[model samples]
Target: MLIGEVARRSGVSARMLRHYESLGLVVPSGRTVGGYREYAETDIQRIFHVESLRTLGLSLRQIGQVLDDPGFAPSALIGDLIRETERRLAREQELLKRLRAVDASGPTAWEGVLRITELLRGLGSPSAARRQQAVLAAEADVPAPVLAEAALAEADPHVAGALRWALARAGEDVVAALAPGLESPDADVRRRAVQVLADLPGDEAAEALTSALADLDPQVRAHAAIALGARGSAEAVPVLVAMIIDGVNDVDAAEVLGALASDPGRADAIKRALTAELADPAAPGPARLRLVQALAELPGPIALPMLRALVSDEDRTVARTAAALAGVIETQDGV
Candidate 1:
């Protein structure tokens, strides 16, 4: 076959076939009397092979090595292709996300588009300061979902706080955007999600935080519990009590529980949960001590009796702390 016939059958353009020949990827096996390039059956097969490799994102140079070098191992090149493909996919996904965010902002003009794009770039910047500035500068123009997504992924405390504030100001619609982060495989991401959800005011945020109560991460559960407790959700009582038992942010957990106890019914429930932990045989001495301190955070009337009862307990440290707390409660009561 001549070059024209080869191009027609193999779907490689004549110009490209000539370029391939120049690179020695697939030289014609013979020549006609007029000195035009002529291809043998084997040459056509090599052209098809080069086209197949191009579909796998192989560069011309890599294809040359693959086809020409008998010693070349394809596994290494395949691995590199995989990595490059992954990176390209990640870039495309990020671009799509940015474009969606911009479109969701409902930009009315090219100026609005440019402004949102700049803000998004700032939010995604490597510098925490720039991200913080972006969040602080964000207003009603920035969509709640955008802020929520940024808040969930933020690592720096200051930047994260700003993003949460922005999300909160953006309104309760952010709950939908933030909900997925609660199920994230990364504990840190789940924690951040709950943290922002805790500050957001709405049933959606509350419901999201309520679900997070059972999160495997202790910190995530603690945050959710505290938030729920503050929102007057009795659901937080058990986890707050557990936080006391585990000595993880037990002080803050106890404070939330004490606030929850302001209601008579809730006060009784909180009292039972605390006393139950204190009475458990598996409860360690240190945990008991923490529980004793947590009990004091309750209303004086509710806590004083428990404190008085604990004063005579077997653990001397628990007794001393309880006795001291009981005395203070008694003096406050003028008993």
Candidate 2:
């Protein structure tokens, strides 16, 4: 076949086939008597091979080596191609995300687009200070969803705080944006989501936190419980009680419970929960002692009876502490 027929059948342009010949990658098998290049079946096959390698992101030079060097082990080259492809894909995805974010900002002009782009660049900067400045300088311009995403991925404590603060001001849209982070497979991401949600005002944020209360991570659960309790949701009661028993942030848990007990019905429930723990013989000494201290946070009248009963308890430390607390309550109550 002539070069034209080969180019037509193989889908390789004639110019590219000539370029390949120039590089000595694929030379036509023969020449016509009139001097035009001619190609044999084997030469066309080599042309197809070069094109196949190009699809795998191989440079022309690498393809030359691959086609010429029979001893070349492709494993290392293939691995390198995979890594490079992954990096290129990551960059493309990031660029797409930035474009979407900029579009979401509803920029009306090129300047607005540039501003949003610069802000996004700062948010993604490696320096924590730059990330923080991006958030602090955002004002009402940067969209809430962007801030929420940055908040979830931010590793620096200070920058994370700034992101959360920005999200807090970004309004209810932030709640929806943060929803996916709550379901993230990464525990740290979920924890950060809960932390940001804790500061977000509104029932939606509270509802998101309610879902987080069931999170498998103890810290995630604890943060959710505290946030819920502060929101006056009784849903946090069980976790708060558990915190006391486990001695994990027991003091804060007790204080929130005490505040919750301002409601008469909730007060009764709180009293019963504490008494039940105290009655459990299997309860550890430290846990029981912590429980005793927690009870002291309750209203004087409500805590006094439990405190009085515990005064002569089996554990001397418990007895002395209870005795001291009860006496103080009695003196304060003028009983």
Candidate 3:
């Protein structure tokens, strides 16, 4: 076949076929009387092969090595191609996300678009200070979704706090954006997400925390319970009691439970829960100690009976700790 027929059948443009010939990638196997390039069947097949490799994201140089070098191994080259394709895909996906965030912001001008883009970059910056700055400048029109995403992924304490603050100020709509992070496989992400939800004021955030109370991660459930208890969600009573028993952030848990117990009904429930845990013979000594200490934070009328009973308990350490706490509770009552 002549080069024209070869180009037509193979879908390779004649100019590209000529370029391939110049690069010695697929030279014509013969020539006509007019001295035009002519291609044999093998030459046309090689053109098809080059096009096939290009679709796999192979560069022209890599294709040349693959087709021309008999000693070339494809395994390493194929791995490199996969990695390059993945990197390109990641970049494209990130760009698409940024564009969507900008569109979600309803930016009306090029400058608004640019500012949103820059703020997103700052939020994702490696520097904690930069991330904090981005969150602080969020009042300048950063979208809530962007702040929510950054807040969920952020590990730095100060930056995470700022991001939560910004998201809360952005609006309650961010609750929807943040709700998914509660189910994240990463426990740290789930914990951070619950913390942000805690700071956000609304029934939406409260509902999210109430749902998170059953999360598989103990830390996540503990954080959720504390947040819920502070908001007067009595559903947290059981988890708060458990936190005291497990000695996980038990202090904060006790404090929040104390606040929740200000209600007469919740106080009665909290008092019973604490005494029930104490009644379990299998409850470990350290747990008993932690429980005794937590009861001190409860109202005097409810805790005094338990403290009085525990002061003469079987365990000496428990007895001493309970005695000391009872004295403190009684002295405070006297005042």
Candidate 4:
């Protein structure tokens, strides 16, 4: 088969296929005397394995070694894959738990909390709750946030309250381990702080969250906007609105802000964020899109003009979002 056929069969782009070749993961089985690359059925099948290994979370270098793994039998290879998958899943679980438990800097425990947390790490990722009763007993040895995270999935309000009370006396060392997860190294630590700050209650969290606004991650800035919506601060609206208008991830950021803007006080903040960009000449179509959506959610004569302007905008995508907004308004008004 030709290179194109290999790409078609493997669902890997031709450019990436060339990259794989450079990485030495695959080589054409033969070449024509005239110099055309020729591949065999075996080579195409090998490409699928490469794709599979990449999907399994192995880095290219790691994948290369996995392909070259020796002493390990087939069963051993499967076990390794399962272990890796579990590790990722555990990280996600930890992130979600932290999201639920974070309160703010106040009175929290440090020593006992660390002891309790080892129990969690011992849970081997997703089996996090397998040792529940023992964990709850040692819970006082953990951080309040970690304790709260551990109990987030439960429904009983009384149980939840009890957990919160326990969180009050959690140890400091445990607090250190209660960090959030992020894919980017720089974004990771800051995002973790942001998650904890936003979830934690009171003035300390507010101060921390304000500082987190300078985070380089657009996604984090957008999330900060949504978190502000819950707390209903006039100060955060402009930044969130600005992000909705011009941030690269405006679509997601706009959606979060819109959801949080239901409170009357937040309306003006979001409107302020949107109105400036509603008429911005240099901003991209998506900026206009999120702004229009935000304006539609607020619903006022101010937005109607922007919506009208959008109907005739140069960008088809912006015009489309505006048209949709107009339709939503018409539906609401019984037009």
Cα RMSD (angstroms) for every candidate in the order listed: 1.7, 1.7, 1.9, 19.6
Clashing pairs in 1: none
Per-model C-alpha lDDT, please? 0.90, 0.90, 0.87, 0.61
Question: Weakest 10 consecutive residues, lDDT, candidate 2?
Answer: 138-147
Output the better candidate (2/3) by TM-score.
Answer: 2
Clashes of 2: 0
Any idea how many clashes model 1 has? 0
- Prediction 3 TM-score vs. true: 0.93
Each candidate's number of clashing pairs is 0, 0, 0, 13
lDDT of 3 by residue, 1-335 (tens): 88778878998899999999888888999999999998888887889899999998888888999988899999999998789889999999999989899998998899888888888889778999988887787654577778888888888999988887787778647888987798888999899999988888889889999999999999999989998898898999999999999989999998988787778978888888888899899999999999999888888877778888998899889999888888888898893
Cα TM-score per model: 0.94, 0.94, 0.93, 0.47
Can you write out model 4's per-residue Cα lDDT over 1-335, one digit (the tens) per residue? 87887778778888887888899888788988888778898888788887887786667876777676765365666677799889989989876754344323322566434554455554324443443443555544444555544444333444444444454456343333334322236664455445544555665556556655666787666566566656766556666776766655566555556665566666566665566666668877666666767667554444566687778777888788888888778777766
Q: Per-residue lDDT of 286-308 in model 1, one digit per residue for the tens?
A: 99999999877888989999999
Q: How displaced is residue 24 in candidate 1, in Å?
A: 2.1
